[model samples]
Target: MARRGKKPKGRPVNGWVILDKPKGMGSTDAVAKIKWLYFAQKAGHAGTLDPLASGMLPIALGDATKTVPFVMDGRKVYRFSVRWGAETTTDDTEGPVTQTSEERPSRAAIEALLPDYTGEITQVPPAFSAIKIDGERAYDLAREGETVEIAARTVEVLRLEIVDQPDAETTVFEAECGKGTYVRAIARDLGRDLGCYGHVVELRRTSVGAFTEDDLVPLEALMEAAEEGRERLDAEAVEAGAKARVVDFAPLDDYVVAPETALAELYEVMLTDEQAARVLSGNPVILRGRDAPVFCEEAFATGHGRMIALGAIEEGAFKPKRVFGGRG
Candidate 1:
């Protein structure tokens, strides 16, 4: 007989965790922490949030990782504060100040420029960004003391408004925009247009797709929950007088959101056991009845409350695009 491969460590936990990522932590680091907390076998994030920014960072564990692309395409809402009178190389407080201006714009001047940024607009990304230049990250090049010129691209900004003005030197604005929109770029451009060079001093993301501020769970809370769960497990093992006991990971279920939450915008179809089996086997099923969707570019199916697959509908037939399996 052929030798069996070593089993992967950790449980096969599946779900989304809308982490309220704190500043100074990278997106990848946050995902690693969450994966360890649940002892999950696999994990990924929907969007990349910088170390200088905080707020909703949707992390997917196990099977939920398959839906990362959908979440990445969802709208993002951010509230950031810009400090006038100086421009930094990174377009944020993280970089050195390269320029300074004594000019300060009135509230009315800021309001008038909001319309220009709203709707479809062309904007250049910050030099210290993740954009690839000749297969190398732009930020890496910039850090190496190399000048990087990123091309301008069009991004959709649904809404932009001045939410607060703390003083003559700072202005806070909130923006709702589509994928690829950078809040740092907005602050940089606004400062330049107002004749007072500025850079982002504070940033916070409040929403992404189906996730909102209400769903955010601070990192401290997750760590505390994990520590408490481990303690409870140890106590139970002691009481039972067992030398060895299997670890139970059910306590952290409360923090895990349904995987379907990321695909809220897609239509959902309920499938029978046989139909679900077919879908899991990489086959399509014919949807029946008058209420069945005739044509849909993207949709999902569930069988007995378990997600079956992500697929497309054509002439009432649901074609499985990506089938899910092995428990959520």
Candidate 2:
């Protein structure tokens, strides 16, 4: 008989889980484990992490899934090690070696090359990446023994440093970059620039947007918490902190950063009860404080310290692009 999966239970879950994903598990698997633990109605992740990569992965459940785009577009920090003198098929340790060299650059040489990678620059995406080409996944094509062509894209590298060079064969680096930046691409390019070849052997993301490593909860811990809280949650029918506790794995809230807190860096607008109601209904309302703000532009809106919506200011009117917390 075919095995059947457990059906999801309870009402919609609305929050984020900053998971400290362990290496060897794919991003989808990590999300599935969390979703099953909470029996959440819906769940998704902000960004995809490679199986070989480990560290902070922010998973969104229910309404928090609406804010995923904002998080994916946010800044990212990574600490990785590049193995010198060999390039791999996948540009990582898991792939077979495609090229080799004995030329290893010194720390000074690597530092001199740092400037080239920093700031806005164009680079090609890896063939074994998730980028789509002609409506098909690039990685799938690469793995199928088909030729893959991933175009060069312009990405912003805010910071790139040669953190350490433990040996002649390895160079460790830390980078803070904007969306669409690929660490594997940097490794490959750096090796080529140094007259040798290189591939990423170790990669770990330290942070993504406002989420940090400190915000992460282990997958096992969350599963255990769900197991222990299941009976209480079923009996209580998910009242009070029931919803939160069911999935809360980090800092008593499962890293569910409030929309207001998450978007704290942006400008805010406080709506009246009537205006909040209007926004909740997906309508725009005029405001008094600002003078004719641009239309369809994004900003944060809140009421009584709670996030009401993240939307746009349109010609002295506030439009609700996304309503958070079922407050609508």
Candidate 3:
């Protein structure tokens, strides 16, 4: 007789895991590995990466999972190589060759076309993506040989620069873009604009939101460090050890920047502790200084008494966008 019953599992803790995703592993796979490694209560990644791509993949564990949407809205930067004269079904290296051309443009020609994509532009996501259509995954529909119509989305290309233009068959470039911009689509659209077919051969995300590759820890190294009792350490030690690892694996407090920090670039504001509490409680509080930027956004918890973030005043009152302290 075999026993088939539920086993005992402990509750999962809340935290963030910045994974230095390796090529050939999908984002979901990475999350599963981390979840298993930590026995996390819950885990999720801020964004998805194709199996063929690599780079920073932020994994939110525990309560951090609740913040995934906010983190996903942050901008991203990538370095990728585009191969000209060829197109693929998935728009990347893993896809089967759908089309190819004999003509390849020169470096100058490719550089000239870069400007066309430098600013805000409309882009269509690849059909072989996670996008949903009629409540079904687009990739699922695409795999079944069904043609799916994906609407074009507007994305901002903050920066687009050619890093290397080796001949004309391949071009290595770097791009910084806002959320929802698909690099594969950029390659595809660039090919269309340049009068040639193109597909992404290699893609590496350098930054996402306020996080960069410099802040990621390789899966192998992270596993080793965890085994060495790194995970049981404090925030200061984590920050110190991160320098040696050549990655920023510091705790959530280090990288989970406040929304007010981003807003600081827009305006500045200051608020009293009492006013901050009111704002955090969902009630707007009036500020004295109107001309000067007011910082009223407080992420601190009412119970814990530790301050997290201070937000700016928009109209006449203080609005707390993110509170970090207390139970969270």
* Local lDDT at 121 for model 2: 92
lDDT of 3 by residue, 1-328 (tens): 9889765363445556778899999898999988766665678898998888989898887556655765688888899999999889888987898888888888778878888897898889999989999999999999999998999988899899889877668999899998888889999888877778999999998787766666677888766654554335568977886432212234323433333222222334445687655655656566575364344333222222333333445565655555544221
Better of 1 and 2 by lDDT: 1
TM-score of each: 0.93, 0.86, 0.74
- By TM-score, the candidates rank as 1, 2, 3
Query: RMSD in angstroms, candidate 3?
Result: 8.3
Error of 1 at 164 (Å): 0.5
Task: Quote the lDDT for 19 in model 3.
Answer: 81
Which regions of candidate 1 are displaced past 4 Å?
A: 1-6, 232-246, 326-328
Model 2, 104-194: lDDT tens per residue? 8899999998999999999999999999999999999999999888888999999999888889999999999999899999999999999
- Compute the lDDT of residue 292 as modeled in candidate 3: 46
TM-score head-to-head 2 vs 3, winner = 2
lDDT, candidate 1, 21-115, per-residue tens: 99999998999989888888899999999999999999999889989999999999999999999999999998999999999989999999999
Q: How many backbone clashes does candidate 2 have?
A: 0
Q: How far is candidate 2 from the true structure (C-alpha RMSD, Å)?
A: 6.5
